[model samples]
Target: MTDRTDETDDTHRPGDQPEQHRVTDGGVTAAPGREGAIPEEDTNVTEVFPEGNLDLRAGADNCYKCTTCDTSCPVAEVDEEFPGPKFQGPEQWRLKRKEDADIDGSIMSCSNCMRCDSACPSDVPLSQMHNEARGEYVDDQMDALSTEYVRNRILSNYRTSAELASKVPQLANFAMNFGPARWVMEKVLGVTKEREFPEFAEQTFREWWRERGGAHVQSSEKRIAYFHGCYSNYNTPEVAKAMVRVFEHFGYEILVPPQKCSGTPMFANGMLDDARRDAETNVENLASAIADGADVIASCTSCSLSLRQEYPELFDIDGVEDVSDNTFEAVEYLRIYEDLEGELADAELDGQSFGYHGPCHARNQGLHRQAVELFRDVDGVRVEDVGDSCSGISGTYGWKEEKYDTSMKIGEEMFEHMKHAEGEAGMTECPTCAMQMEHGTGYDIYHPLELLEDALVD
Candidate 1:
């Protein structure tokens, strides 16, 4: 871990002589009399280094070693290899700073869910540090130019794969399911054949939006651009449709832009450069809509977290602050709308009961009860907080052969709870969690927006 904070700050004093500022990597030029600081005028240049390239200065200094993060880690409860977030994060951070080799491979298991950061009593940025270290470790160990690297890169650049799969849905779905093809994928790409992957849609959400002339919807006092992420656009267009219908019912003029993936899959799989590229494209695409005073909303909680929180925290892309400020999860947006305009349209669900699995990323966003609150507003819908447990399929983490068993193990508790819980169907904010929960318990699962859309009154 390289510490940038140890470098002296160039605070200008009246008597101090101006010094030349050097340009750093990624083309970011610093102002005169400063070190590694971005010029205020150049919004394109970022002062923040890409993930794993920079280290936190005194990041773990606040750690009292109370092990609160350890106790709170959902991953640690399942995998003993992960000595909990404290060991893999704060404690390991200290060891790595002293000696790089002292840090072990256990850090790779971190899902970068930011739960440890949230649970830390001393506010240690544990998850961030662990992610950074994982990057460093992989970079040192793996040959980036190798065939294995290429396969991993392909797996990580999920947007590209999804687009291709969507274009040839049947072939893609068959290839994924076929035994011989699965063996080839496991051998060549390190993707596991044991777990089921979500099938790509023949008609994506954006495709459906274009067919319906979704872009030309009449403008209203309340306006929003739907950031229907890759999963909705590729694998589950129904969820996106439900979101649009529900939003329209509430008098929101919805704008469906052709958007790229939220780059979370890339981030989770250690493909930092790919994630940065996707993030840049999205920020550029949303700039105009955001300037026109439209709130950017996403149905997927992970996508919302990526836009609303991860962009600034991980990439430090220019103009992302504006996007982050404007972005909202669909349910979060609904809650805000209700707060401003009074209760939502009294939608009748006919007394349907559902269990809610708060996605780990959603929980990381401090949205513990907001999903339930949104569901509670629906007439005759029962929404229970099934627990704050993780679904354990953190992005593409569970799809790799090496991680399949551990991923299933991590999700066992959540799966068991859902199996026994009383619910006609499962409700969640994440598409991946919905898939995992369904696979785990064989229950009909849905995003809450889907249910709300079905139950809309008048």
Candidate 2:
């Protein structure tokens, strides 16, 4: 089995000379020694701020020091050492652009959750500024071989790690569970031993789909392309299966198109160049599917957000807008494009109650109520909105050794909410949120589709 921590030559120095990088297929690529580095000129800040003449500083000027972003930040509420998004985002962004100032190291604490964006009255693009600043900081300040660098690289490339481990899942699980191995990982990779690693599935979703001859299904007029993301593909195929089963029962033909990770991990870990690559690849593939008369849907809220929002905001790529326009959160797609509420009206939940935790990404996309509304008219089924609280595990953010305490601290309210919620189980559209909630509270948490699948009548 490949060692998860073994460093490959994937580091990219985007701060290097522009001559060392070349534009290929609408993305910047670095020279041999600095592979995957995107040039500074190709940063693509214009996509988000078309009125700013391609300058991110214009957005920063909108902030009037309101502190709404500061108050909305979950990390600021928990970690005093970390400054709020107002400081890390717009405040520093102005200085960084005008004076060429270094990004405050606190920028890493922003978590890309977009709560600040949602809260800002002035509509400042705080998260986008922080993301760009993080990439700049990493390229300028971080040593390529340092512990932080290597650890983040490993975490950001989770798709590769998961793929390799899934090939030999028993051995991988044993190694993960083994105390000594975890100690070594803690010492070397800086992954906290306090939290258990998410185990790889014995069979990947793609593999299972292929084996079941799902790829051979006949095409239908109402066709959809599925982007299962890495979590559903590797850690929990059941989520993807439930989505597939539910969609198939609704008379839609599903296409599991080729896809990379949605790049949320990379964006969080300051691996923007790799993220750009993923965005490019996914946009190209999904766009082709869209052209062939299929709308894209993702069960993971983060994945859907990436497809529908992040790709267009972060990259100046072709067909991204079209891809974004067609992409939908699985539940949101069903609620909008299908008669989901009517179909589920006759479906029975048999006195089941669930606490629905709207994930940050889902709320960012403004589709947080889709899942709750689906069960509104169903008899004997009560789904409560347990408040919009950050789960503190922003994708891989909670798994790092240094952030574990802050992560738990930020999550305490959410954990408390679930413990006292009027349900035997909880439902969320985010995989990491589900993981963090289960770890924080003892209750089982599931994707909303999983419960809906069980409740669907023949």
Candidate 3:
């Protein structure tokens, strides 16, 4: 396991880097990511800032030290060394990566948990910023490996979850019992092990959409082409169905466009190239939605986070790539159209208590808080704002043994909160957090939207 520790303390020296700290025993495996990759100046570099991604840079600069971001971060909660986005970026990556150097490798630890985005006081959108910063580290080869790995290693031979279960007992109940498997994957692969990955559902949302003839696209009115992120599309088809139902209640039409993975889960794994290619495909398909003036609404928080945030940074590196701009978190899109109650609306109280975990991408988008409010509006929803940032899952960061203990240690605050919360169950808008919370507390969790979909008045 890599001797990874959080290093973003307030007093971090300007010259410090993740690589700088890896020298304790006089020798270490020569830092894997940066050694072979040579920084070559190409059209891609020029594309990164065509007319220039000035707005992206400018947007990153906006922040006030409310510590809301630092305060709420799940990773920061555990790893005090990670100085939150406000510190890591505008403070670190943006300044360092531009040196045309290897600074991009240093941010590999972000985990993409996004607790800071939820807690940020200013409009920094730190979640998106760090995502972009991470994108800068990508190259084509990285993408190829993940595709090769998932296709060749896991998906092909591992015929069913049951087969995967033989290696890791938790994989048998992957949707629920993924923590231990993820823990092992992290130890061996450097991937975060804490994430509650979506089970490859017996049926997918796309298959369901096909059964319904790919839900008609209502071009005339303001519409949404809901991009069911990985989990919603695969394991949690009900989440996608529920979202469609939620939108339908308002007479909004949904077009199940031919979209695949948003690549965020892969991206979090540092499989940048695969993520970039996935971004390219998504951008092209989504252009039709943008052309129709429809906002690309997504229920999977990470996908929405990637589309609105990472796609632009990674795929648009040459500056000319066209990813649709009009994207919204499912809740963000629904919030504007539907009025939420001040308290839990129709949530089944039947002696039920609830814990609310916010997703990082949603938090960064300023929708995490709204998600909490949405649950609060539910009649029987008992909301405990656990207030921790990333849930230490950092997507799959918690799963890696190298970062495993740290990730769990990082998740301690939320673990304590969830343990103390008087809830019958836990719910998070972010899928990754739901997985992490479940592992930490052994409490069943659901996305708030599924709950909303069930409770909505037709």
Off by over 4 Å in 2: 1-54, 215-220
TM-score of each: 0.83, 0.86, 0.68
For each candidate in the order shown, give its overall lDDT on alpha carbons: 0.74, 0.82, 0.61
Best-matching candidate per TM-score:
2
Ranking by TM-score: 2, 1, 3
Candidate 3 accuracy as lDDT? 0.61
User: What is the Å distance of residue 424 in model 3 from its true position?
Assistant: 2.0
Predicted structure 1: lDDT: 0.74
- Candidate 3 lDDT, tens digit per residue, 170-257? 4445534456666665555444444544456665677788888765535468577778766666556777888887777667877767
Worst 10 residues of 1 by lDDT: 1-10
lDDT of 2 by residue, 290-389 (tens): 9989999999999998877667767888999899889988888888877887888788778988888899998888878777887878888888888877
Those runs of model 1 whose alpha carbons end farther than 4 Å from true positions after fitting are 1-55, 100-103, 145-148, 339-345, 377-379
Output the lDDT of residue 30, model 3.
36
Clashes of 1: 0
Compare candidates 1 and 2 on TM-score and give the better one: 2
Better lDDT candidate (2, 3): 2
Clashing residue pairs in candidate 2 (N, C-alpha, C atoms within 3 angstroms): none
Q: Residue-wise lDDT of candidate 1 within 1-458, one digit each (tens)?
A: 11224233354322243335444443354466754554545657443322234556556656778988887787787777678887776677666666535457766677766677677766676766766666666567667876556766787778888888888999999887888888888888788877666888889888888798864446757889889888888899999888888787777888766577787876665666777888898998786788876889988888988887667766777788889889988878787665522444444667788888988888877776776876666677788888878888887778777777877887887888886777757888888788778878888888877776776635
